[model samples]
Target: MERMALGTEGIAVSRMCLGAMALGGVQDKETSYAILDRFVELGGNFIDTANCYMFWLPDGTGDESEHLLGSWLADRGGREDLVLATKVGRRPSFPGGGLEASEPLTSERIAASLEESLERLGTDYIDLYWSHRDDRGTELEDTVAGFDAAVKAGKARIVGASNHVAWRVERARQVAAATGAAAYTAMQNRYSYLQPRPGVRLPEGGHVHVEPGDIDYVGNTAGTALLAYSSLLSGAYTNPGKPLPEHYRHPGTDARLEVLDAVAAETGASRNQVVLAWLCGHESPIIPLVGVSSLAQLNEAADGLELRLESEQWQRLTEAA
Candidate 1:
């Protein structure tokens, strides 16, 4: 797979990022390790996870994903070859308290989360650390300064933001610039070839969708890259059993799917690969965070790096959406 710049910084990573959300909970340890091994074998270097990764299970716990990744890293060795990223905030519903009780992005929370993540991952530093979501209650400067402090203290190499809107990202950057703090170099948000309906709302929590204004901002930003989560619409484009997300099942979706199907046939690529190629070949740099539970799914994402779309084909797909 081809390696590309992760953000404005000098950091580089594989074109496609492997998401480990299902590592510990949905998939067993053995299966998760096999997938991770295959991903590394295929030259993937970027792996993303969050501290509060799956809290809804009956066991009522999180960090299972991080623990599994840590185990794999121990077996694999060569930690220098990989780009490790994890997020804080988004308190999962557990026993004592949840997101409703506490605000993330505070200096104390940021520092404490970093320490816990390091302990779980068995790493001293994180390549890219993210504020899982914006804490509207806290001052922007405080959040920026907190991340910068982590970077300065060698806890995290770089900081990023996820589930943030355009204005929030810009404001945070301005704060970082003014205070000489570490600014966000990349944005992780929900984006895909298919667009959600006008009135569609996510089963509400901390999830943030990418808006048109966010696209404009990223297009103009020099060093920032967009790490699009759910870039393949959760495999809706290819899997017959995987229906399109509820928010994305609008009038325009069928049209977009038709073009996607035609292009996939014409290019001799799978629908998943075609959608991924569209994101990679777009005007703005978008590195898709593809969540894979199996080695076959990981292979499909890896193969997508080789499927390039012509300008006309891209235009057709975009217009159809």
Candidate 2:
């Protein structure tokens, strides 16, 4: 796997980050372990999870993924070699409370949540700690200070923002600069090869799609990289049974799909691989967060990273619409 500098903090991460959202939830323990092991074998080190993962599922306590990763670390015994990332601020405050009732990014809550996540992951410090979503209700200074305290206390190495718009992210960074606190060095949002029509609301709660401003911001700014989630759109690119969402079903979608098929055929790769390759080689550059259910899927993603598209081919794909 290729490595890249994550932020100005000197932390290095893999080009492809493993999204462990479904591990040990929809996937069994043995299967999750196998997938994780294979990912490491392929030289991947970055893994992302959150405290509220899979909470919407029946009987989920929202701790399955972290708990499973903790067990894996205990058994595998390599805490220092990997870049572990998990999030907070999105978990409900009490049982039966849905996402709307999530905890605020107060100093007290941030402190408490970090302790719980540390316990669940069996780690002394997290490589990357994310503010799962922007808490507009909380004072931005308070949120920045909370994360700065974590870094100063040696609990988290770096901090990031997820599911936030570009302007808000810039505002938070300004606050951090003024307050002399830690600033967010990474941005994670919903991104993929096919884009939904502009201003169309996504079906998933708390999903913020990446916009052109986001691309320009990350491209122009130093020490910041965009980590894209839902990079493959839940297998819609390759699975016939899974159709594109209504928001993405426009004429542009048809044109992009036609070009996508042509590129995949030319490369002799699966549609999923082509999509992943496109993301990795984009002009602004993106670190794709991929979730896998099996080793086959993991291998295909790994192979996609090695694919280098010709300049014309990449341009054609980019200008398809």
Candidate 3:
């Protein structure tokens, strides 16, 4: 529950952010509540969710995570006590159960996405709003200008991006510099000890899933922080008894797992802890967003904040993985 300044601004939040992507979708409601409650009890005050969260589930599409999180805020008594960040774009799901036509990033899309998110979250303005994913078709000027308009309208206090490369972030930063608008102050992406490449090949004729290397804190500029989601490798580190899911079972992963095991044993910490804590050693600010389905898992991940790996161990794990 230790706090870190989000971006270079006055917005302060917990070092351990509660990620609600799987909430109300993969995780049952009762269990999700227990996990969230435990996160708060442990002093975590940052919650990150998105409008498009969990719409990928076979059960439903869109807004379940936000609605549930908003309900938690209401129950918790003060929404102002927490720093909330949500995103737009990256809608891979459709209302009728098939992939919809790809959406572009522009003012129209931004306004539509924000309205839906605000409606679902039952809030007037978000503490932080993000572009979610880079829109190759949209001009950075247009996107930054749109966000500037939002800031002027008091729709959001700050804006940022997720899953973007260093150059794209720099481009947006430059646009802000030119216009003197509200600039991106944070980044969120799939960063962790596992799979450092960060890219996924574009589907046949579909949008490319390019890895954003700048998504890492050490590579990010000052005044910006990277929220490392998938911090536990989607339960691979936490659930040792279970084999990794089909998608994560790639070549050289076994070697990475072995390295994680060695680090965990040498440090008397869990593999997830090593991965999460190793991120803290990055040259820039790195905060791992812990996603848990149970309070016990939450406790284990929370204890990870105290785990310190030796420089040798960190190097060995990185090299071996």
Candidate 4:
């Protein structure tokens, strides 16, 4: 796959980032290590994880994914060769602190969060640091100033927003432009044919009203990259045997499947390559984060690297989804 830069931050990364969300938790140590090894073996240099990842898992609560990646980096002996990204705030739901989205991300929380992430990842600097979620209660100025502080402190290289709104992201860039603070260089969101389920209105009370292009709607306004997580509906498009499970299937998923099945039948490409290629085909710049559990699966997912689908094919898939 061709490598893409993380916005203007200049951090070069593979178009397909290996998301380590399931690391050290859902998958065992051996399996996680094998997945990492396979990821690198396939020429994937961009790795993503978080301090609170998989904290909701029955087996983890703290930097499990980071610890696993850190350990693997030690074994691989080339931490410098990889571009790593992680987040702070909103860790797994603790008993009283349940991993609920209600938790706030404040400056103090960010500072403490990074220390733990650094310790877990065995790294001195993070290529990209994200807020993970928008802090609706926190002032935009507070968020911008805090990110500026992190860049100045040498703890984080670039700051970005995750699970954020287009207008909020635009205002954040405005905050930076107004005060010369650090601006967001990327956005992380769960965008996929299945996740949003086209035409399906998001649940009313929380983080809703997110329209299409919100990732780039703000990016085009600020010139940042849109980093897509759950890019392939958590790998549902690739499985040919059974339809996606109840929760995994989104409204647009079946439509995308129809096109994918046709493409798979024609080009001899797997359903995943077709779906993933469609993601990369968007008008808004999309860099889908790839998450895997095995070398075989990694290899399978890696087929999307540089696999550019035709315009008609892209349209077919887009229309289906």
Off by over 4 Å in 3: 92-94, 97-102, 196-220, 240-242, 245-255
Which residue pairs come into collision in candidate 3?
198-211
lDDT of 1 by residue, 1-321 (tens): 889886656888999999998898899999999998898899989999988877656674677888888888888784878999999877553455566854467888888888988988988999999999988888788788889999999988888899999788999999898888899988899888888887567864666888877777877897788889988776777788988768777779989989988999999999889989998997787889999878888898889888989999999999995
Q: Rank the candidates by TM-score, best first.
A: 2, 1, 4, 3
Q: What's the CA RMSD for each of the models?
A: 1.6, 0.8, 3.1, 2.9
Candidate ranking under lDDT, highest first, comes to 2, 1, 3, 4
TM-score of each: 0.95, 0.98, 0.87, 0.89
Give candidate 3's error at residue 303 in angstroms.
Answer: 0.8
Q: Which regions of candidate 1 fall more than 4 Å away from where they truly are?
A: 93-103
Judged by whole-model lDDT over C-alpha atoms, candidate 1 comes out at 0.85
Candidate with the larger TM-score of 1 and 3: 1
Question: What TM-score should be assigned to candidate 3?
Answer: 0.87
Structure candidate 1, residue pairs in collision:
none
Per-residue accuracy of model 4 over 1-321 as CA lDDT, tens digit each: 577667666678887889998888788899998888877777888888877776655655656789888888888885876888888756743543444554457777777778888888887888888887777787878878878888889888888887787777778889998998888888777666445544655442222333575744844654577777766655556565655656436656666567678887877787777667777888777778878767877787788655778888777776774
- The candidate maximizing lDDT is 2
Clash pairs, candidate 2, are: none
C-alpha displacement of 107 in model 4, angstroms? 1.3
What pairs collide in candidate 4? 93-98, 93-99, 197-251, 255-320
